[model samples]
Target: MFKKIDFSFEIKAIGYAFYFSFLPFLFFVFQFLFGEKELSFILLKQMEFLIVPFSAWWIIFLYHDYFEEGGSDLLYSYPLKAEEHGLLRIGVFSALYEILIAICCMFLIVRFPDANFFVLFIQYAAESLLYTSIGFVIILLTKKVMVPILMIVAYVSTEFLTEGSITPVFHIMSFNTEPLSLDQIIFSVLLNGCISVILFVFGHLYLRKKTDLRLF
Candidate 1:
């Protein structure tokens, strides 16, 4: 299973994803260096707001190969079954994303040693998976990159326009005055994790039933 995964592809995708993810961090570093403590916090908050949308976008980018003409054919011709291949690819990408998050958190620790960033990292990771899985299902169903891209845009727009209160599930990373309770954390993880699993399973099944690469 591992042999089927293209480590080079995963690394390149992750590198691109982190390039976006680290933008806020770069601002945070600038603030820290200039002794702008207040601004650093604001930058961190902004990072939280941007992470989910960017993460979702990265997942969509990673799946672009599957939508290409010869690329889809090559993927389908692998030795493994379609569902197995898809699942392995998802697993690899998801794991790589989490690792990237962990690495970012290490850098964040240096800037805010007192913050409970471990918990925040878990929350962000769960939200990332949730958003990515939604995009994954959309791509598998429609086989068009633009559909999922638009869906992500609509979701981010709704979240921002409504201030994270309207669609709580989609805006899990939005700013909050108070710290999240243990129950809230558990709920977020469970809700997103369940939804991600269901979407992945449905996409796998849907892919298994299709014999051609035509985008519907």
Candidate 2:
């Protein structure tokens, strides 16, 4: 199970996640150094927020496609079980993304000091894990890359319509000045944990039942 992911795949995900996250950092530095127009800076920040989620989304799919596409055949021929394989994939990808978000949040705190960066950062990390698992579940069920992309579009569109304006991607929920009470934080983490478990279970079952299906 531990051997399911190749070093090449891990490197690719890590590299892309770090590379894309630099958008916001670069935008802030450019504005501070060159005195770019306010509107241009705001636009760059918005783009950065939108692009961050795609890093995790793309990386999850890359790992899945890299392994499940051809690696599955090799695994079946070995002694590894499907459930173990699925769990290992989930563990690695999720860890990589959590670290990616941590690095992004460090930049965010340096850029925006008015907000409770930890709370918002935690929320963003939770949501990223949830949506990433959902993305994997979609691919496990359908094996089509377009499914995840379309789902992301729908998600962002819904956020835009309901939120009225998109400031920071973390601002999808209303920004709270008061610190999140312990109960609130615990409940939120529990809720996200449940959702992640559900997605993992669904993906595991889908793969187990359709182990022979050809996927792109």
lDDT of candidate 2 over 56-145, digit per residue (tens): 464455545345455545445646556755667666666765665665555445545543557646666666666667777776666566
Per lDDT, the best of the predicted structures is: 1
Q: Pull out the clashing pairs in model 2.
A: none
Model 1 CA deviation exceeding 4 Å by range: 9-35, 107-112, 165-170, 177-181, 211-216
By summed lDDT, which 10 consecutive residues of candidate 2 come out lowest? Answer: 170-179
Candidate 2 residue 155 C-alpha distance from true site, Å:
1.6
RMSD of 1: 3.6
lDDT for model 2, on a 0 to 1 scale?
Answer: 0.56
Residue-level lDDT of model 1, residues 127-214, one tens digit each, is 7787778887887777677898788777767766677877665555636533354556877677777888898788777776673443
* Local distance difference test scores for all models: 0.64, 0.56
The clash numbers for all candidates, in the given order, read: 0, 0
